[model samples]
Target: MVFDRLIHPFCICSFSLTVSRTKSESGVPEVPVPADDTPEVLNKALSGLSSRWKNWWVRGILTPAMISFFFIIIYLGPMVLMMIVLCIQIKCFHEIITIGYSVYHSYHLPWFRTLSWYFLLCVNYFFYGETVTDYFFTLVQREEPLRILSKYHRFISFALYLTGFCMFVLSLVKKHYRLQFYMFGWTHVTLLIVVTQSHLIIHNLFEGMIWFIVPISCVICNDIMAYMFGFFFGRTPLIKLSPKKTWEGFIGGFFATIVFGILLSYVMSGYRFFVCPVEFNNDSNSFTVDCKPSELFQLQDYGLPPVLQSITGWTIVKLYPFQIHSIALSAFASIMGPFGGFFASGFKRAFKIKDFANTIPGHGGIMDRFDCQYLMATFVNVYIASFIRGPNPSKVIQQLLALRPDQQLHIFNSLKAHLTEKGLLPLLEEAA
Candidate 1:
């Protein structure tokens, strides 16, 4: 409350200017109508079809093109993929915040737009700073300014956020107090959803492109397969929020995704490029995907269960352990992932809007397409941390390298003693 006094009379003009920059809105928010911008030939081709059939055709045509572009981005390498992710994150934040502005337009709250963008900048700074420090340690340590920034990154982020928080409190007007706080909460929630999840996605990417590609591909596969099955075979509705979803489609999509995930994992697991964790190469001054393949990526003989062995007359099966893990990823993608979309649908219904924005013709917006993806990203990141990932030796070695020479020598001697007691030092020396 004390901070409210900081909005002196001198600041009113500039704050008013910022508020005026927000798009004009009527008292009532209008539901967005998705634009029909398909090619004329496509429209002509689909002219005879029913609306449902037309939608299916449009999505079918565009989906492959989107997938092709996705693969092109992948081929462009991780940096481009990361930049694209940031772009999407920014677009998604803009779309959600714009919707909030539309809904709260009657109050004409001050500093809403300016503070929203300011908070976006603050969160991006925090997350990207953490990422650079974690993944590019060598580069950060080489530069004095970067090392200091990395060292005090969290404090800087918190201080920057406090500045924005104080500004919001100061800009609040009496009549619009409630509405101002509502938009403030709305902005923070949007940042949590879009920026935070996309950052996890980048983390998964650094683990290995396989970790990134497989989970995303499973989600995409389930979405498309579910739609296809529901179009033809769906009978009983699955949920109230999503009218078109059906039990048949849900069941069909689950099986299809599991199979697709297994096959994809099997193919990807064999390639070092897909399985190796991304690392910064101090020598080449670049990122590298070169490393020894982990046991998870290697094929091994696994004995079948007694029932399966009896039925198939085989006792052993050769598979990548990653293929087994794929089932869990695909299961979540099929079974739990749709709930993210349902939540989004509920959010839209509450706001009396049809979609977040009409960025795509058949699809509603980037948010519409990615609602489940953000959820999936969070799950995959958790799964890797909880079950798949072990302590990274490279990270440990890097930390060791950063120590004082005496500290490094002490650690070396201690490790040598431990290894000698464990009887591994002799074996290691013999191999060397």
Candidate 2:
């Protein structure tokens, strides 16, 4: 009887505890619950939290750190900027060549690697030779060695390239001819994509740091704004090539990039260091940025549109001419620049890879960072050639000064006759 009484009380206590746990303070039935926390469940929750924290750190900290470092390099001037660009070109070429090699891993073609590098050297020789001849003509004239090289640069470049071609042909095995040809084509295409665009980037830099700075800044702004907007509000996907891209991000990035371009132009336009072209000053025996800036860097009054006038009660707005041009540049950056990245995305997807390389922590490789930049460079070069460039009197004068005394006098007499014929110059005083 005593044992039965204890059992009855224990059962009643257990029943009461279960009922109390199930009901809320107001006596409503609560949702069902698991009575025990399993180790697996706890571990999974912890793992998810850890992964989220890692992503957050990479996006917030590492990305900004890299951007800051790049800005510092930009501020160091064009020489440093050019070096950085060259380094990027090499790294991008490396990544692309590595991909091609991986795709044809079975091939053991002879001298393929050496020939690829030789082609790179030949292309650089051609492009940089052109740049030096064009921009530093006086310097080349002063140095006999460089003068000789400049005279035969094209022939030398062609000969070097031909040698590489011959090497490639000789190195091919009968069984691997098809693969060897495939790699040959691949190498040339990669050179066209990487080296040609890089040459244009150097051209843009020579135009002024503004051209280089503004366009690149716009792309960076677009990329950042797009990512931010997408993370918070993206729904509709923008393209199949890049699954994470969204329409919301695209629109957001576009608007942000326009504003960014305008602001960047305004700021850079005020600095002569950024507005003036890089030139070698014979007088100073060093590079100089002292020339009068182009009209694009000058301020112009633009009539405000009706919509903005209604809000601000202003009819005219004064801004740098390049600020106006920035609208087109930014539009292209937001709309078309992303396509460069999309193409890269497609390339990586085909290879079943996540990134070209993990050199930048969260940012992938140098090529990944510069994929959009190369496209922007090409556009900037084309835009300058079409709209901004004109006959440069300074370049003309520099070239004239580089000629021998006899040639100079001959040119002077020819110019005098032409000007006289055009009625711009008075004929010499009659008969001393």
Query: lDDT for each of the candidates?
Result: 0.88, 0.82
RMSD of 2: 17.7
Best by lDDT: 1
Which ten-residue region of model 1 has the weakest summed lDDT?
Answer: 19-28
**Candidate 2, after superposition: displacement of residue 181 in Å?**
0.3
Q: In candidate 2, which residue pairs get closer than 3 Å at backbone N, Cα or C atoms, i.e. clash?
A: none
Alpha carbon lDDT at 291, candidate 1: 97
Q: What's the lDDT for candidate 2?
A: 0.82
lDDT, model 2, position 359: 70
**Candidate 1 deviant stretches above 4 angstroms:** 1-35, 39-41, 394-413, 425-432
Q: Largest TM-score belongs to which candidate?
A: 1
Which regions in candidate 2 have their CA more than 4 angstroms from the true location? 1-53, 392-411, 417-432
TM-scores for candidates 1 onward, in order:
0.88, 0.83
Q: After the best TM-score superposition of candidate 1, give how far the Cα of residue 225 lies from its true spot, in angstroms.
A: 0.7
